[model samples]
Target: MSKTVVFIQGSPRENGNTRALAALVMETLAQSGVASAEIDATRLQCSHPGCIACGRCQEGPEFRCHVDDGLARAVATLPDYDAVVLSTPVFWLGPTAQAKMCVDRMASLVKCSDAGALATPLRGKILGLFATGATERDENLDILERQYRVMAEYLGMPFVSALFPFCGVPAGQAAADPEFATVARDFGVRLAGMLGGRKCCDP
Candidate 1:
């Protein structure tokens, strides 16, 4: 079966740098005969109220959130995909508010078993973080990467990579950088290869 990857774009601006990079990645994945889905978090009517510590998901064999919203839908669909790519623009040294909201809502994925041990539906999944920013400094990038790394660890997922193409401001600026496109495309190819059951050597 062909692998399916979901690309979630967290930038509120249409045609922003993050979206452009995500598009490039998706295009490359398509060329490799991999299925892809793009989810624009800003476009969704996601009023995620965060996790209320409700024990509903642990109440039955079927794990689910009581909230009826787009976030609930996202949590349900995320586990079905083989890999997930999160693309966002740096805002205040972290993911944009829209992206953070989605991430916060993901707490619902943590289901409690009858033994009361915590578990997440995201186990064994592959996750990649892609971001763009106006600064080329590592300070902001470090913050973003740390956050993503922690999130991946918490969900029991392997962080495939974190790609940051910097100096993107005023939107669409990164489009002029051919190097950024090359990097994004290469990252996509590698992710596609991994999805195809290829082992990646660490360098």
Candidate 2:
């Protein structure tokens, strides 16, 4: 079976390092015969006020957000893919506000029960993070890594991550740096390996 991965872009800047790396990775993914899509967090942030915990989704006639906004609409389509990658440059060592809000609104896709939170539509799908930081210290990316790791485990999705978390480059430089480009392309190749596995494709 074929696979598709959706990358949620968290940078507001049109040509930042985050996008640069993502472009390389996406190119590799395309060459590897994997399909990909992207969602801009900057656009998605305006979609909803926030997840209100209205319980409407969990209590539902339909298991989804009742907000009737863009984020809600975008999240409803997540189950169609084989993988989800949260890609963003670090802001104070965490995701940008736009990205965080997009993630918050995704609560609509998960239903919490007495047993625990269940990411039914998203469960078993591959979850990944592509976090770039200007700092060379690999530790600078710990917060973003932990954030994605925790989310993946909680949602019961198999977790993977892109290389060069530090990236250690300025805005828009990832494309020019041959080393970073190699890392980024290899990340896509790695993701292809994960998504191509029979276990990942099983329903």
Candidate 3:
């Protein structure tokens, strides 16, 4: 069966550098014959945005994300995919507020057993980040990578990333650079490799 990947659009700002790079990556994956879909955090219609720690989802293994909202419903099905790529712009030394909030609320997807064992639906799936930030990489983008690496390690998911620093200086500046597109295409192939896909056609 073909592997499925979900691109989570974590940027609140549309038509920006991050979004452009994300589109390039998705196009590569499509040309490689990988099945894909997307979830835009900006468009999530959630009355209760972020995790409330209500323990409703933890009540049973079958229950996942009990919140009654579009985000809850969207995240509840993440287990069905083979990979998830969070595409966001770095803001204030981290992922955008929209992206971070989505990640926070996804905590509801973790189902802990009565035996005190923690299990999340995201297990055994690949997790990747496509993030662009301003300033030097070590100063900001690397910081974001370190946080995401820790997150992937704890979640037991293999991690990959496309971190582009010194981007979006003038908002969408990176989108005009051919080098950025090349890097994004290469990163997409790397992500697809985790799902056992190879480039069969040009993107």
RMSD of each: 3.8, 3.9, 2.0
- TM-score per model over all chains: 0.86, 0.88, 0.92
Per-residue lDDT value at 200 in model 2: 24
lDDT of 2 at 190: 87
Candidate 2: lDDT over CA atoms?
0.79
Top lDDT model: 3
Ranking by lDDT: 3, 2, 1
| Cα lDDT over the full model 1 | 0.75
Model 2, 189: alpha-carbon shift in Å? 0.7
In candidate 3, which residue ranges exceed 4 Å CA deviation? 113-116, 201-203
Worst 10 residues of 3 by lDDT: 167-176
Candidates 2 and 3 compared: the better one by lDDT is: 3
